[model samples]
Target: MYQESSFKHDAAPPMEYFLWIIPTGRASDAYGYSQAKTPTWSDYIRETGNNGADRDDFDDAIDFMAWFVYKTHKVNSISKWDAYAQYLNYHEGWGGYKRGTYKKKSG
Candidate 1:
């Protein structure tokens, strides 16, 4: 599945391409930027609700992924292992991970 995303495993600039792929694998609806049941739109999901727009889902996902990595995770240092860790942290907020839903359940 990793290679199917068409992402190089060890990118030079350190992009966790697999992170985005995981979500796509789980939800093809991600490609349409459709939130399935949530009311979230890429254009309005930001905390301020005024800093986003209807851009490509993959690009928006990448942007949000970076936000999760450098901001939410407060990652003082990055490593390959961080990609997998932060992916869950992004999927479920850091608090959600502590609550075990992020690490335990599929939903």
Candidate 2:
């Protein structure tokens, strides 16, 4: 839905605005942040433990989106969940798209 629209449309608003719509925070008794706690992009990243690193630059945007969706939806796979979380954390503050690993063009 949102992910597809974001990826397919060039005129779409920046990912930051879309990400802001998702909530973030923790309810009492919750062990981790929730959609309710995320009010801003920075807040979401901070609460999710994405501290921003160079490694995240190499990941596809779709991968990030899928991981974000999975986290927001509270999916069940521990490995997938952790992998997404780590990726998010690794690439937090960086912006702009990087070429896919298989792309012929060099950055």
Q: For each candidate, what TM-score against the reference?
A: 0.41, 0.24
Question: Highest TM-score among the candidates is held by which one?
Answer: 1
Candidate 2, residue 45: the lDDT equals: 56
TM-score, candidate 1, is 0.41
Question: Residue 19 deviation, candidate 2, in Å?
Answer: 30
Residue-level lDDT of model 1, residues 23-106, one tens digit each, is 223332232322211233342355525365332444554454454466544533434357766665545555665575755665
- List pairs with backbone clashes in candidate 2: 23-35, 23-38, 24-35, 24-36, 24-37, 24-38, 25-37, 50-89, 52-92, 53-90
Instruction: List candidate 1 segments past 4 Å from native.
Output: 1-52, 55-57, 75-81
- Give the lowest summed-lDDT range of ten residues in model 2: 28-37
The digit string of per-residue lDDT tens for model 2 on 35-104 reads: 1112333444565566561112323234344555555345322344565443433223112112222234
Quote the lDDT for 95 in model 2.
20
Q: In model 2, which runs have C-alpha deviations exceeding 4 angstroms?
A: 1-40, 53-60, 75-107
Query: Distance from true position, residue 53, model 2, in Å?
Result: 6.5
The best candidate in terms of lDDT: 1
